[model samples]
Structures are given as C-alpha cells and as structure tokens.
Target: MPVAECGRPASPLIVVLSGPGGAGKGTIARMLVEADGSLRLSRSWTSRERRADDPDDAYVFVDRAAFEVRRADDGFIEWNLFLGCYYGTPVPDPADDRVLLLEIDVAGGRQVLDRHADALCVFVDAPSDAELYRRLVGRGDGADRAA
Candidate 1:
C-alpha cells in the first residue's frame, strides 16, 4: 500500500533529490535547509559500511536486525535494501509544517512519487561525467574509469 502524507495527501511538499552516486545531494539538502527555515531534511538510517570521516551526526547507523525492527514497526517513511546495505527515511513529524526533503536514489524517488503524486521531484545532475568522477575521487573514494 502506498503511504499517504499525513492528513494533507493532496498537496504536500515532498522534495525528492536524486542523481548519480557522486552527485551532491547532501550538499544541496544542507543548503536548502539553511536558506529556508521551513525546509526539513529527513535524516536517514543506514546499515552499511561507514566512511571513516563521515560525521556520525549524518545518519543513524544500525545493524541489520535493528533496522528490520524499525521497519517492522512502520517507523520509516520508506526503506529499502541497496547494494548489500539497508537505508531508510524515518517518519517525519507532519505537524512541523515544513518542506520535507528526502535525499534518495532513483528507486526511492519513484516510491515517493507513487505514494504522493503531488510531490515535487527534483533530479539533481552533474555538469559532466568528468566533473562527477573528479568530485567522487576527490572525496577520497578511488573513482573507477567507468564511473
């Protein structure tokens, strides 16, 4: 069943930010929230290999069992297993009356659109493949030529 927006299912501003792996979704989300106080970035929970310097404040890192428990309890707006890891958005407090920005992948974006047809989906794109590769490699992950 598609998850409906709390109360106002007709027109809720569910902003979806999606792009290639190296595209700057996190940066954009931060900027949007900083610029507009009414924008809320939904913090995601993950059960994945964490990066060494990733600010622990970024995501709620958990083991697979814990994540599954949350999912079973319907604590997530959307959850999925990706690339051998789990990732999900926690249910936002709808009473906040803010634009909820969900930084998700193409598949997750589709799920949000399916649930809320009125959602504003924004596809963030890189200037070029070279630029994306450069950014990815610069981030300390050895970029592949095919990337």
Candidate 2:
C-alpha cells in the first residue's frame, strides 16, 4: 500500500450518494468529481435502456442476460432491482487510489454499508416533492412512477 502525506498507509475513501430518483444525485456526483480530480465516480451498470438525453458515459448499459451473468459472477459490489430494471455498481479496482463516488439508491446504500463500514453515505433530496415529481416526469418517467 502507498503511504499518505503523514506516512500512514493510504486507502480509497468510498463515498456513497443515495436518494430517490430525480433527486439530483447524478448532478451532485458529477460536480463533485469534476471539481476534484482525486474523486472518481463509479459508473453504474443498468439493464434499463438509456434515456435519449442521458450522457454517453452515464451508465454501462447492458442486456438483462448479461447483467444476470455478471451478478452470478460476483462482479457487483452492490445490486438492486427497481421497477423491473436491474442496477448495480461494479467493484472498484483495488489498485485505484482515488476516492470512489457511488450514485445509488437506499437499498444499494445499505448493501454498500454492510461491506464497507467506513464509507460516508449522503442522502440527497429535491427541494420539494412537487419539484421531484416534475423532474422525474420531465426525464421521461411515467406519471405513476413519478408520483
């Protein structure tokens, strides 16, 4: 292991940002990583289709079968099934020295905490319920799902 400025062994800081959909978790995570070169946002893999407005690097889009195969192979550090879609975070490389940022949901946060007790978890929320619903619907989620 590498030593820090104080000479103690260095380890990556796992930071988890979790919240309901349309709560701006992704936006916050992106800003944090862009502002700090040492913070790396781990790209999540999803079985859901990528939205048209989603950035090219938003996620590692994959088919359900491929996602299932990866899950069976223990490729994910945390995984969840939401609204008929599978979402998971791949295990970060052990050699990576940068801090890791995970944008996930409540259930995934629990799983990460179970494995990494030292992780810092932040819960993000929208300014209001109305705003959250509006954001969700604007992002193409059905009204029922947004509600």
Candidate 3:
C-alpha cells in the first residue's frame, strides 16, 4: 500500500531548480544528481525538437498529442509551452525520503512553488551576461532573443 494510505510518515524532498533560458540550472542539477545517490532526476517531457548535443536520454521527446493526453490525465505536476514547444514534468514517485530534482523554467517553477511550499527552490545562473551567453553558445543553445 502507499505510504499515505498506510499512514506511514514519508516526507520526500522535492527540489525545483529554475532559471532563464541561457542559465546553468541544468548543469547544476546534473552535477548534483551525479554526486548524490539519494537524489533522482525527474526527466521532463518536451515537444521541442532535441538539441544537437542533447544526450540520448535528456528528455522524453513526445508529440503534441501525447503531451496533451498526459496533461489531461494529470500526469504532469507542472507544464507549460515556451517558445512554441511544450515542456512538462511527470509526477514523480520517488522512494521514501529520496530527493526528486526538477530542472525547469521560470513559469513551470512558479507552478511548482504554488503547489509545494515545502519544495526547496533554487535559482541558478551564470556569473554575468557574458558568461551566460558563452555557456548557452557552448551548449549549442543560442540566445533565444537579444539580451
């Protein structure tokens, strides 16, 4: 039975990492998850075309219809469309006391904060505009617009 149904106390940790498009939030998240055994990364679903250098398992690439269906089924805890592409986080069911890390954008981060007051919210970014631009360019994600 589920912990809630069993009346067992299991307070899982949810970490929501958010920042601007060219920010280093993803990099930070990756590093944390890699270094911590108790932290699990919640891979989000996206309808956007994958980036050239994106890893094979960076995201669950789905079409619009599939994404909408998941939304209708309440699969995603938070979701939004940015830059004409849909991005959503699937409801994570981590083991008891484990930390679930979510690397998301500003809008989706707000949605998560509204639902989860206990979540640890972390905003990550480069040291300066030049650094941010340099990171984005290096990652093959050009600036979405003029800074």
Candidate 4:
C-alpha cells in the first residue's frame, strides 16, 4: 500500500539537505545516498566554478549563459542567486522510484519547501560561527560574509 499524504498517495519524498556554505551539506547528503539504497541525490545546476576540493559531480557546472537559458525556459523547480552566482534544481522525473536528495542553498531550500509542501527538510547547521568561518575560508569561497 502506498503511503498517503494530504489524502493522496505520496510521491517519492524530496529530501532537502540545506546549510550555509561549507557547513557540509554535500558531505552529509553523499553519505546518506551511499547508505540508503532508496535515495538518489539530485545534482543542482550552478554557474559557479567547482572548488578545487569539491568533488567533480558536486554540481552540474555551467556558464552563466546556459544557466540563464535554463532558468528562462522554466527548467528549474526552484532557483536562487547567492554571492552573485545562480544555483537551481531541475524538475525531477515522476517515474523515479528513489527519493530525491538535495543539497542546496538555504534560500533555494525555502523555495522548495514552499513549492512542495510535502518535502522533508533537514538543515545541517554549523557547530560554531568560528568553525564555519574557518571552513569557508579554507574552501576559498569568500568567507568574509560569514565573518
């Protein structure tokens, strides 16, 4: 029997793993997907170049032009700009059986929650402000904002 949500059979759950930059959402999401056969991580699209330490598959790296084209074409379910870079999640295939796992910026995560009321969200918080700042600087991703 299918699980019922809001009086209807629940679709595969969208699990949003959100956090501030360098808070390790990607790491946690990867671990979850590796451990759970039922989860499939959705790689978000971004105009920003991948960091040296970032895994090659962290995001669907694209130029600004391509990102804008997709955004204008209504390809993303939710999108946001952070530190002057565009990041967005694509529309998922309805036939997919594995639950979607997303590691995204906080703003975009909020948008997802608003759009999908049934989404299950988990915020990966930094242990401390100082530690978060260190991680940001170490990643060379402009930690000045966090400072």
Candidate 5:
C-alpha cells in the first residue's frame, strides 16, 4: 500500500482506532464517521455472548460455528481472541478512494498496521483513566461498556 502525502494510505485507507476498554476510541470514531460521509465503519463479526442491551448495529453476531468457518476461510483481515470471544475485521474490498475506519483492540490495530504499512493508526486517549471510566459508565445508550 502506498502512503499518501497526508500519511494515510492512498486508495483504501485503513484507519485504526484503539485504546483501553474504557477509552474514548469508539466515541471519537463514531463522531468522526458521523460528521463525515467518506468514512465507513467496518462492522465486526463476533462469536461472543450478546448482552440484553447490546446495540443491534454494533456487530454481526454469529454463532461459534459460523465464526469458525469465516476464520478457517481467512475472511477476516485481522482477528483476535479477547475476553474469551473472537472479534475480527472483515477483509476490505478495494476502494478507489475511501477511508475505512476500524474500531478494534490494540492487537488488531497492530495487525492492520503490519498488513498495510501505509495504514493510519490513531490512538484515542482520555485525559485520565478515571475520566475514561466515568465516560464509559456515563454513556446514555447504545454504548458497549462491557468488555
């Protein structure tokens, strides 16, 4: 992948947002994506147990067998076992000019950076850990606070 003048990938720019569980990475990613039309959020596939209040749009919830099938077929660009469940970013299709935002863990972020050297890696950090925890707890609705 070729790096653009702005330090992002040329055609299919992979933007990775990652941080601690309580960090504001997801919030920032959502804000940037909602404010911009060019950015597209890659929905993740997960084999984890879903919460009662889990957002329907958060992930494409699948059973263990289905997740294993995708994993065996290498359908994911990057996948990791976190909190006893599997999470992965689907392989992205070629885009003429579009920024793909991936909200994943640090491990997955490193994987994207390694696979696509030109990809831009953004680490969203809160002012303090306490503040992050507060924000996580204070999220009104549709926030994945359980990790």
Candidate 6:
C-alpha cells in the first residue's frame, strides 16, 4: 500500500501464472511480458538438468546444493521440490520497477498467495488430458514424468 513520489503504488503488481505440466503457462507468460512494457517475467531457478531444447534463459540452472544454500538464505519468494528436483522464484529486485510475473506450479502459487494476498493468480489447464500428454511428450518429457 506504499505510494511512490509519482503518486503510483510503490510495489509492483504480482501476477502468478500457474498450471499443471504441458498447460501452456510458459507460452502465455512469455506473451504477456512481450505485450506489456511495464511487465517483467522473473526467471525462476531450478536444480533439474536443462533439456537440450530449452532456451538458455529459461531458468537460472543450479545444482541441488547451490539451490539449497539459496533457500537457506531466504532468497526465494517461493520454492518447491517436484519429481526430485528443486524449483524456486527468487525475490524481486527492488530497483526493477515493473509488474512481476511468476510462472510456477500450483503449490508455488499457493505459497505466494499465502504471503502476498493481493497477487493476481491465474491457473492454466490443457483442453484435454490426451492433449496435455502430447504436449508434454513433445516437449521432451518422459511419458512417466508427464503422466
């Protein structure tokens, strides 16, 4: 509720885009950031191995130990362990001065909501289970993991 000298809200609006795997959350997040000059996507950190097809900037890749160390230091706004890998959204830099966009899962969204009650949360879902599986496999995820 803080106000800036320019008469705007001091804190950037927090937007949480969450969904199950293969639900197009990443694509939508990218589109939203691209279309809005005042919005910035906060890249997430992950301990999982980067896939060959993944964009270089998709995540701030790190080893599990490093991820744990950051978690211990309270560097993440929300962090979660999924399928034996760790993923987290880092706390926004105060100087960024833009609306913050978070692309994460439901659990992470819940954590963010617990801390920032006013965050705008959007849940994306695939049109059908079969299509979700197809998207997952097409994206290089193993069938077992996709399921």
List per-prediction Cα lDDT, in the order shown. 0.79, 0.90, 0.81, 0.83, 0.79, 0.90
How many angstroms is residue 39 displaced in model 3 relative to the true structure, after the best TM-score fit?
Answer: 0.3
> For residue 55, what is the lDDT in candidate 4?
84
lDDT tens per residue, model 3, 13-76: 6788998876877778888877777777889999999988889988999999999999999999
Candidate 4 lDDT over residue span 1-147, tens digit each? 222222433587888988888798978987878777777999899998788877888889999999999999989978988879899999888999668888887887899999898887888988998898888888786756667
Which model, 3 or 6, shows the larger lDDT? 6
Clashing residue pairs, candidate 6? none
Ranking of all predicted structures according to lDDT, beginning with the best and ending with the worst: 2, 6, 4, 3, 1, 5
Task: Provide the global lDDT of candidate 4 against the true structure.
Answer: 0.83
Give the winner by lDDT: 1 or 2: 2
Q: Residue 117 in candidate 6 has what lDDT? A: 88
Arranged by TM-score, best first: 6, 2, 4, 3, 1, 5
Lowest summed-lDDT stretch of 10 residues in model 1?
1-10
lDDT of 6: 0.90
Backbone clash pairs in model 6 (N, Cα, C under 3 Å; residues 3+ apart or in different chains), count: 0
Off-target runs (Cα >4 Å) in candidate 1 are: 1-12, 144-146
Q: Model 3, which residues run further than 4 Å from truth? A: 1-9, 94-97, 143-147
User: Measured by TM-score, how close is model 4 to the native structure?
Assistant: 0.88
Give the Cα error of residue 40 in candidate 2, in Å. Answer: 0.3
Q: Tens digits of per-residue lDDT for model 5 on 1-147?
A: 322234543467888998775577777878888877778888999998776656888899998889989999999989988767899999987853668889988999898888888777888777986676676666532245432
Per-candidate TM-score against the hidden true structure = 0.82, 0.92, 0.85, 0.88, 0.80, 0.93
Off by over 4 Å in 2: 1-9
Q: How much does each candidate deviate from the true structure in C-alpha RMSD?
A: 5.4, 3.1, 5.1, 3.3, 4.4, 3.5
lDDT (tens digit, per residue) of candidate 6 on 106-143: 99999999988878899999999999999999999989
lDDT of 5: 0.79
